[model samples]
Structures are given as C-alpha cells and as structure tokens.
Target: MTKLLFLVADGMGDWPVAELGGRTPLEAAPTPNMDALARRCVAGTARTVPQGMAPGSDVANMSLMGFDPAAHHTGRGPIEAAAQGLELDPDDLVWRLNLVRVAGHGPGDAMLDYSSGHIDTGRSTPLVEDLQAHLGDAVFSFVPGIQYRHLLVQRGGARAPEAALDIRPPHDITGQPQGPDLERFASSPRLAELRRAAARRLEAPANTTQANAIWPWGQGRPLLLPAFRQTFGLRGAVVSAVDLVRGLGRASGMEVAEVPGATGLLDTNYQGKVDAALEFLARGGDFVFLHVEAPDECGHSGVTADKVEAVRRFDERIVGPVVRALQGEDAALLLTCDHFTPLARRTHTPDPVPFLLHHPRLADHALPAFSEAGAAATGLTLERGHDLLPHVLERLRG
Candidate 1:
C-alpha cells in the first residue's frame, strides 16, 4: 500500500486560541479547510517529547519523524548549518550566528528587537564578508547568511575538545546567566571568540546598522545516526522551505526535494510545494514530511493577522492537493503540527498539538471537516509526540 504522511510543523504557536485560553494565532485565525479534514479523520492531540523544556527545531523535527529525540538529538546549530549548505567534519564544530543589534543601553535598551528582522539577506551578506576578512582562515572560519544570521566553523587542530571550550552566550535574550565559564557558551571557543569580537565591533555605534545586527544561536554539529531508511525500513522524502529541515533530511539518507519558486514568506509557492510532494510520492516514497513556515514567522513578529492568514492559505492551497492525491488510492494520510508557535505568547507553547489519520477503506465519512474546533471534539484523545509514528504506521497497515 502507498502511505503518505503530510506533516505540518506550522511554525510556533499555531493552535486555536480558544483551546489555549485565547493566546494562539491558530485558534483566532480561520482555517475552514483544515477544520473540514479533521472531521473525517481520527483526530487527537500529540504532546511533544521531554516535557516543559525548550527544544530547538532539530529536536522537535526528529521527534515528529519517529526518532526518539532523547536518543537521536544532537543540536540545532549543526542542523541549520547543514540546511544553509555548510558542510561538517567530525573534527569540526559549527555554530549558528544571529545578526543582532549590539546596543550598549540599560537592560531595557540593552536588547533591541528587529535585530536583522526578516530575511534581510542583502544586509547580512556584507556583514558576513567583513567578518570573513577579519578571520582570514586561521583556526576559525566565518560563514555568512542573511542579516542577523551566520555560521562559524572552527578548523579541528590542536583544538580538538578544547576548541569547544571557553565560550560565552551570544545574546542576552535567552537570559543566559552572567558568567565567565567557557563551558556555558552555546558553541566551542573557536567560534565563541569570533562572536565576541564581532559583537564588540557591532557595539560601536558607527558599525551597527538597521539590518546588520548580529546574533548567533542554535549551536551543534551533525550527529551520527542510523539512516532513516535503515531504522524505519521505509522509503521517505522531506519537502520544506526551512534549511535545517532540508539539511537533516539529506543527512538522514532521504531525498530532500525542493519546491520550485518557493519562498520563506507569506507569498510562498503553495501549489508548487504540493506538486513537489506528489512528485516525490510518485517516485516511490512511502513517507513524506512537508513543512510550512508561515505561521511560525508570524509568531516571531507577533503578527496575529499574518499568522491566521498563513494557516488558511496553507489549508486552501497545500492541504487540498495532498488530500486529493490520496483519494481512492491504497494509501493513508496523516496531518498534524510539530509544535505550537502561538502569536499571543510569541514563542513555542508546550501544549499538545492536534493530529488526524484517514484511511480510504474506513467506514466514517460522517466525520466533520477539518477545523481546530472540530479536532477538539473528535474523541481521539491526546498522546505524546513519540507515539505519533507508531499510530500512523498502524493506520497505514489497515
């Protein structure tokens, strides 16, 4: 039987507002189409693993892909770096850099938000080039992305384990405790020294610019793991606009297909995204993971309308096509979010997310159409993220 799993990690905080006390964009927004699908499927909420702790995109995605995050999780820096086309050596260490405004103000002014807001890649690329000139390929190398984001690669030499030592927090946003411990920094020293130097340069009023702010985050390297094909015994593919998701898919022995003309914005190529998934499925992929960034980006900006609109647009454009592809075929379709990117909170919510499964031979067309409110009433009950894969596999067998 052909099996397709269309997973939407609909960005942070995308659940219904009513369910989470009116704090999420997903609740406040209109998603008539998604609501309709929930009606005819086995719907329920799935709790993300490890409980209460804040995990990066890599950990969260690994959980949804049916790998135990605790066992397979390495870090987000490596994942994002990979997505950005940075290669890694087992001896090398990679760190994610954020383009942040290094303001010398009081605690309130100390951190100005909009630090390289959006993918202002134009401003970011120049800043990266400047930094590269300063480093000059010594023990450390600087890699740049759009404004406020970059990657620092440390050449493995005499700095084997020590290369990872003596680092400091890149930003005050995480409220990292004030300390001199190198071990406390997110990444190793080769990258940490470069970050500190860059921050100092940006701290000077003359060096800072509206879109040239620097802030680095999500630090780690490619973790060794059994290929997804070997572990699950299933041929799979991943389609996404996120670099980290794509990089991880590539590392795990799966085809990371690109959606033509896809952009990481509200105006992304939705039809093209669906078409790519269909193509991958036709090419013999039994497991397919699709990612959308609309809701998440809105949450980051705290934009309620954009978040809601993104979700609706995703449903109308992405969902319909995927569902249509599965109809009358010997296949199973499952839908869900990775984590909640609530607009109200402007961060990821620990709340369990709603998911549904539909098999063609099932006896219930009486189920309601997909919607957040209807999913809550499906009587499917809630479980943790780790159980999602097993549950979907069972439905595929039926």
Candidate 2:
C-alpha cells in the first residue's frame, strides 16, 4: 500500500499586494521546490470554508481533513479544550480566552493586539494562573493553553440560553474600537466583573508589550465524531504545532505527533516536523497530515516580506525534505492551504485556495507553477474542499 502525506501551509493564500508589484505572497516567494512539484502534479483550486460560515482555521481545517464543517464543527473552544486534556460535559460551555491588548481603559478603546504581541508561554502561563486563582469558582474555570490561547469553561452553562452570547474574535477586530462589544458583555454583571479583575491582575511590571485584558470568544460545547481511520479506512497521524490541529487530530482518532521546537511560529522546528511525518509513514502509518502556521501569523501581522519568506521556508525546509525522502518510495503528497489570510485585510477570507496532488506512480502534468494565479489559470477547481481528500485517496489507490 502507498503512503499518503497531506501538508497544510496555514494562511498561505494572499491577495495581490502593491508592495510586491501586484504579486501575492505565494507568487512572490521563491518556492522552487513547490513549483517543481507542481510540474509533476495535478493543481487546482478548492473552497475550504463553506458558505455562510466564518473563515476560521477550525472550520477550514475540518473541511480539509474530509470532515464536513457544517456537521462536525462545534466551535474552536471545545477543540482547544480537548487539546488541553480537559473533558467537557454535554451541558458545559467552553470559550477560547485570548490574552489581548487594548489601547485605553474605556469601552471605546481599540483592540491593539490580539495575541498580546504573541506573548511567550512563560509570561502568559502565570497570567492564566492568576486568573484561575482570582476568577475561577464552582461555576467557571480557567485553563492555561499555549501562548495567548487559553480556555474558559462554564460548567453546565450551555443549559442556559444566555450562554449563546454573541462573541467576536479579537483578531477579527484588531485596531478597531471595542466599545459596542465590550459594552454588550458588560451588560452581564458577572462577566463585567471578571473582565475588570482580569485587566487589573494581568498588569505585570515586567510586561511592557504584553496584554492587559482577556478576550473570550468562540464558545461551544464538546463534539463527538467518527474516527479518521473508521471513516477513511486508513490509519493516520497529525503533525502540527498548533493546539487546534492537534485537538482535531485527537478527536478524529488520529495520533498527534508533537515536535520539540514546533512553536507554530516562523522559528518553529520544520525539520523536526518533517522527520516526524516520515517516521510515522515508515512505521506502517498509511497517512499523515502536516501543518505549518508561520505564514498565517505573518498574514495576521500584515508583514508582506515576512509572509513571502515564510512561504519560501516552508518550500525549502518542509516540502523539499519530504520530497527527497520519498524519492524511492510509493507515496502521495497533497499540498494546500486552509484559507486566505490576505495581508490586505489582515484577516481570513472565504476564498478558494490552490492545491497540488502529487504521487510517484502518477504521470506528470507539466504545470508551470504551484500558486494561486497558476492554479486559477488551469481552470480546474473543486467546489467543495471535503471532496478533495476522498478523490486523492481514490487516485492514490488506483
């Protein structure tokens, strides 16, 4: 049986930028390895984010992994909670509490930084501990996760209709005034109190560029889904640095492989992840999903050059090594992004992303490049992202 590799470069899609002379980051980057792979593969566009759904990584990744987001996605909170090993009851409501920075004390203050300047785990962990000590009670609890990303669980709160509060992701409103949203949350005396206390307690003297507030959003209950192996008839593993991906892997009954230096940043251990994926396949695994988040972070920060460099690194470090390792092997490789985190908007867009499917037994398509424009030029597109996985599997088995 042939092995399969599904590689996701998060937020790799981008709109044309004036700074790069009308070329998107993926097009502008010098990704010779990816371009070469395109020549020997079938390339096309796929809509990962379904209609009327928010363009979040949770939804897009679910679709990419062959799970229908409309049916499988509960929310991001439950996924991250699973990653932290926190079990949730049917009536429990979980929220993703992000350490964010606001400009002023008033409600009209702008959301200055969503990830609290991407604060290190060492500093953010203590702040979460302080919140747990001060704000946690019989009804609510705070659990520390990775840097800036944490969880807040309201036990049995899902039984209340009010638990379905309208919450916005802080990253979606960066540099925008939070007056309306803050005022709405403040209408609840309990939430207001927690917000005020968190602001005061998070103020550390050593923290100059860190967060002073906790922005909670993406609330939902736990989800139960069929195992990946059961659904696809292939034992697989997931290699990613982000908790969301790992949690999805866990929930889908796939092994989650953690790399030592996989920080989900530009400095993440690319070689470590590559090694892990190849090792899993060598050890009788039928499939492996590898994800990288550096391009997404760069898109969120609106850094054009960094986004370009990130794509280059992904091609050189991850894709190149994996291709070289599988030179004499019977394996298949699928490369694509979940969604478009355009630098122009500094947020995710519900746009189709390019995908390349390469297999050693397949004939070369002789494509010119592996990019948005290049894929669009092919005029081949997959209307639904979930269909791509099954199609790849069918082709691989053939």
Candidate 3:
C-alpha cells in the first residue's frame, strides 16, 4: 500500500516581484527541500482554479482534492458550516460572515479592514456569540469559527428575497470604498436591522476588537460530497487550520485533523500539523492532505517579504520533514499549491500553479528545483486542476 501525502502550500503561486529581482516569491524563497525533491519528480504546472470561477481557496482546494468544483461547489458558507458539523436543511442558505471593522456604511463608507485586523479568535468569538444571542431567533443564527471567519445561516433562506442580491467577498475589497454591498444589505430590512443591531453591540465601549461590523457573503445551500473511500478507494485525512478545508473533508467523509495553534497566518503551528498528518497515516490512514494557509495569507497581505518568508517556512518546516520521515516507507508525495494569490492584485488569479508528484521508486530525476518558473520551463502544463490528483495517483500505482 503506497501512503499518499498531498501537501499544499496554499496560494504560494505568485507573479514576479520587481524588488525580488523579478522572481516570484516561490523562486526568491530558499526552498532547499522542494528543490531537492523537484530533482527527482516531474516538475510541471496545474491550473488549480477553473476558468470563469472566482479563485477562492474553496474552489481551488476542491480541485486539488480531485473533485471538480463545477459539480460539487455550493458556496463558501456551506463548506465552512460543514466544518462545524452543523446539520442544515436543504433550504438553509448559509453565508460566510466576517467580523469586519468599518468606519462608515451609510452614505460614504470605508472598509477599514476586511478581517478586522484578523481579530483574535478569543475576542472575535465572544462578539459573534453576542450577535447570535441578540439576533439569532430562528431564521438567522451566528456560527463562530477561527479568527475573523464565521457563519450566518438563514433557515429556509433560499426562498428569501435577499438571496438574489449581489454580495461580494470582503478580502477582495479591502481598503476600498464600501459600495453596493451596503445598499444590498439595506435592501433587506431584516439584515439591515441586524447589521445595525450588531454594530451597537460590537462597537460598545466594552468591546476591544476592531470588529464593529458583520459582513456576510458567499451564501448557498448545503453541500454534499461523495465519500473519498467510495470515489477513490482511499481513506484520506485532511489537516488544515481553516474551516473551508476541514468542511470539505467532513463533506467527503474523510478524517479531519484539527491541530492546535494552526492559525491560518504567518505565525502558525507547522510542526503540530505535520505531526497530525504523520500520526494519521501511521494509524492506517492511506492518504493525508496537509494544507498550510500561511503563504496564502501573506499573499493576500501584499507583503512580498512576508510571502517569501512564508514559502521558505513551508519548504523548511513542511516539505523537508515529511519527505525525510517517509524515507523508508512506500510513499508518494504530491506537492502543489491551490492557486495563485498574486501580490500585484492582492487576490487569487486563474493562472497555472506549479505541481510535482514524487515517488522514491521513480527513475525520472532530472529537474533541479520546484518553482513557478522551473515548472513552466518543463513545458508540462495540465489544463484542469482536478486531473493533477489522478496524475499523482498513477505514480502511487506504479
């Protein structure tokens, strides 16, 4: 039995940075371990985000798991709701709610911070709980998650008139003027009043976090995924800090490992996540999807140095140890990122990201390093991101 490790450094794909000699963060970062692995694996690129779809981590990682997003995607909220193990009715429309800090929202508004400075879960948790207590009756209830990420479910929301409004993701509009999002929220009397009520509570003098507002978007019905063991004949475990990844695992009937201190940020628990994945595999799990969100968070911050350091950490802490631990085992490691969160745009792009599938038994060992440039140089580009998993599975079979 070949143990499979699907390692993902989320949003590590990037465009060339002028400050870093026109090399992407992946190239600028010192990925000695990834470079060494690339020498043995067939280096190539995979388009993780399908064309015409928003390059959210949800969509990209779904593809990485070999599930076509076009078929399985419901929305970001339902996926995260699954992470919480919340049983939802078919008509329940869950919306991803963020504890945002905004100064203005009436006439001229500013999105002071999309994540409310990535508010600590300690502070953000209580605030959301308060909202639930105050506003949650039957139709709307708040669900707390890590950091600023949370959820709001509307009982039978699909039939609500507000469901047709054009909502947007908060991260994509950071440091920008709040536009139709406010008007759309006002269009719904209940949500508009809820927004006002939430502000009074969140902005109270007792509240410390900058989270004075609640931004809700990415609403959809419950998501259903086929069992991984049934679809692929493999018992898989997913290790991730974000609920989005764990939600997918839960929906797919895979084991989801929750590691302590595994914040989806630069300062996350890398060693803890690695131990969880390795332990899962040691105890009869056939595959583990270890995802690191630090690189993606850094990419969203638009700080090139932070992203470079994040990539380096991924290479040193994640890639090096996992490969070394599986030295004597019959294992195959598929290394890749979900999508490109280019610093230039400060958002995800529908561009091809690099990937490498390596097995110790393979004889093809020619590439020197794994990077966006190096992968492109190999001239092997996969059109659909979902195919990358099947390609790696073939290596395990061989």
Candidate 4:
C-alpha cells in the first residue's frame, strides 16, 4: 500500500530577524533531520495563500488539504463551527469569537493582546458560559472553545443587513487603535449591545482575568466540502490541536485523531500526535495530515527566541520521531508550512512557503537544509498550493 504523510508546522516561513543575525527562525534553528531530508528530497516552494486573500490559517490549511480555497472557503467561523460538530441552520451566521484583552473601554483605546495571554480553557470556558447565560437569546448563542477562542451563532443572520459587516481578527490589530473595527461591529445593532455588555461583564473588578472583552470576527454560514476519499481516492485522517484544522478535516469527511494534552502551544503533546498518526497509517489509512500550531503562536507574539525554539522542537519532537518510525515503510512524506507569519509584520504574509517532499524512488535535490532560500534555489514553484498534493500522488503512482 502507498502511504502519504503531509506534515505542517504552522508559520514556519519567516523573514530574516536582525537579532538572529539576519537569519529567519527556520534558518537559525538546527534541524538536523530536516536538513538531511532536504538534502535527499525534492525541494520547492508553494504559494499556499491565494492572491488578494487574507493569509489566515483557515485559508492556507484548506489549500494544503488539496482543496482550492477560492472555490470552497466560506469563512473562518464556519470552519471552526464544523470542528465543534455544530449543526448550523443554512441561514445561521457563525462567528469566531475570541476572549481578548483591550486597553480600555473606549473605542479609541488601543487593541491589546489577541489571545489575552493565551488564557486557559478552564478560565475562558466559564466566562463564555456566563456570556451564554447573560447574552444568549433566541437570535444569538455563545459556544466556548479552547484557550481564548470561542464561537457565536446568530440565527438567520445570513439575511441580516449587518451580515455584510467586516469584523477584523483581534490578533491582526494588536497594539493599534480599535475604533474603526469597533465601529464595524457597532453597525450590527444586536451584536453592538452584546459586545458592550460582554465587555462590561468580563471587566468586572472581581473577574481579574487577562481577557477584558469578547471579540467576534470571521462570521459566515457553514462550510461544505467533498469527501476526501471521494475526491482523492484515499481515506485520510487529520491530527491537529486546533479547531480550524479539525474543522477542515470534518468538513472533508476525514477522521480527526484527538490527542489528549494536544495544546496548540509549546507544551503540546508531540509524542501523542506522532503515535496517533502512525496508528492511523498502520490501520490502512492511506493519508494523514499532521499539523503543529506552536510556531505560529510564537510568530504572532513576535518573540524571535520563542519562534526559534518552537521550530527546533517541531524538528526534534515531531518530525524526527515520525521519520524514524516510518524508516522501512513505503511512505511519501511532505513537509511544509501553510503560510509565513513574519515576525517583522507580527501577522501572516502571502509569501510562498518552502516544501520538502521525500519519496521512496525520488532522487535528492542536495540542499543543505530546508529553508526559504534553499527551496527557491531549487527553481520549482507551485503556483497553486492545492495542486501540490495531487501532483505528489501522481508522481508516486507513476
């Protein structure tokens, strides 16, 4: 049986950091196994993010799953809604809600940390329950998610006049004045009051949490996609800690292997993910997508050292072990990031990301290590990232 493994380390592509002596985190990190893999694998670049699209995880990961984002993507919220197995009405609008920390109550106040210091689910979950208790009504309901992420459902909001309002993600506006974005939500009469009340409730003196407000963005109706097996002729599974990726797997009718303690942070259970993936493959599953989110979180924080350490850990913990485990198997391994979360920008960029593909029969490109520059040097560029997977499969069966 031909096995396929697609591994993603979120936000691994990055710009050169001055503090790292003009090397990006991926370049600065000593990933010995990845270096050896690149020297013996097909190296290339892929533009996972389409033109004029916001370089978000929802979009990029969709492309990586061999789905065309421009054709299939509805919005970030609905993808996450799928993760929770929410049965949304066709006209119900689902929004990706975040427990965020803002500087003050006024609209002029600067937006603060997006993840609210990555508040634990234990604390954030109760706060969402409070919102559901206080603000959830016939037209709206709140659903708690992991860490600082959550969801809000607006019944039949797809037909509402405010459905056209474009709410920005809190992470993208960190440290900037939030008046304009706040005004966008204010345009929604019902959501406006909900937002204000939620802020007040979260900021109550006794609350004493980093998250002072509930930020709702990325709203849309539910997403729909063709089954992965039907589309690719391969039964596949997804291993990830975040809802966005799990939601994508669910939407595509693939299995999701949930690993306990699989936080999308630095302390995530890397070994558990590796075990789950190998188990799936051993059980005759033709394909698997293994995703790690810690690097992306560090990218959002703009901490160079943290990002470097995260890349090293991914190499040492996830990639290293997986490669060793599959040494004698007839497996094709593909390693890449979904998009670039440039530390300089403190957000995602549409730049092309490096990819290394290792197949049983393919010759090595002889690159010293897997880096943005080494990939470019290969002179192979995939214009549509969604096509890369199918292309690899075709080559495998050739």
Please name the candidate that would achieve the greatest lDDT relative to the true structure. Answer: 4
Which candidate has the top score in TM-score?
A: 4
lDDT of 1 by residue, 1-398 (tens): 56776658466336445544664555555656566665566776667655644544566677777767677665556776666656667766676666654343223334445344454666567667777887538666678754455676666632366444433334324223233433344345544565567666555555546533344445555655568788777888888877767767876778888776565678888888888788877888788888887777676666667777777777778777777777776776777777776655566666666676776555343444554454556566445576777777766675
lDDT tens digits, residues 142-223, model 3? 9898899999999999788866767878888877777778888889999989888888888688898888889989898899
Q: For each candidate in turn, give its C-alpha RMSD to the true structure in angstroms.
A: 4.2, 1.4, 1.3, 1.0
Clashes by residue pair, model 3: none
TM-scores of the candidates in the order shown: 0.82, 0.97, 0.97, 0.98
Residue-level lDDT for 371 in candidate 3: 82
User: How much is the lDDT of residue 51 in candidate 4?
Assistant: 93
Any runs in candidate 1 off by more than 4 Å, and if so which?
12-24, 84-86, 105-108, 146-148, 156-193, 200-209, 363-383
lDDT values for all models: 0.63, 0.88, 0.88, 0.91
A best-first ranking of the candidates according to their lDDT comes to: 4, 3, 2, 1
- lDDT for residue 175 in candidate 1, whole number 0-100: 27
* lDDT of the structure predicted as candidate 4: 0.91
Tens-place lDDT per residue, model 4, 15-106, is: 98999999999999989988988878888999899998889999999999999999998889999999999988999999999999899867
Model 1: lDDT to the true structure: 0.63
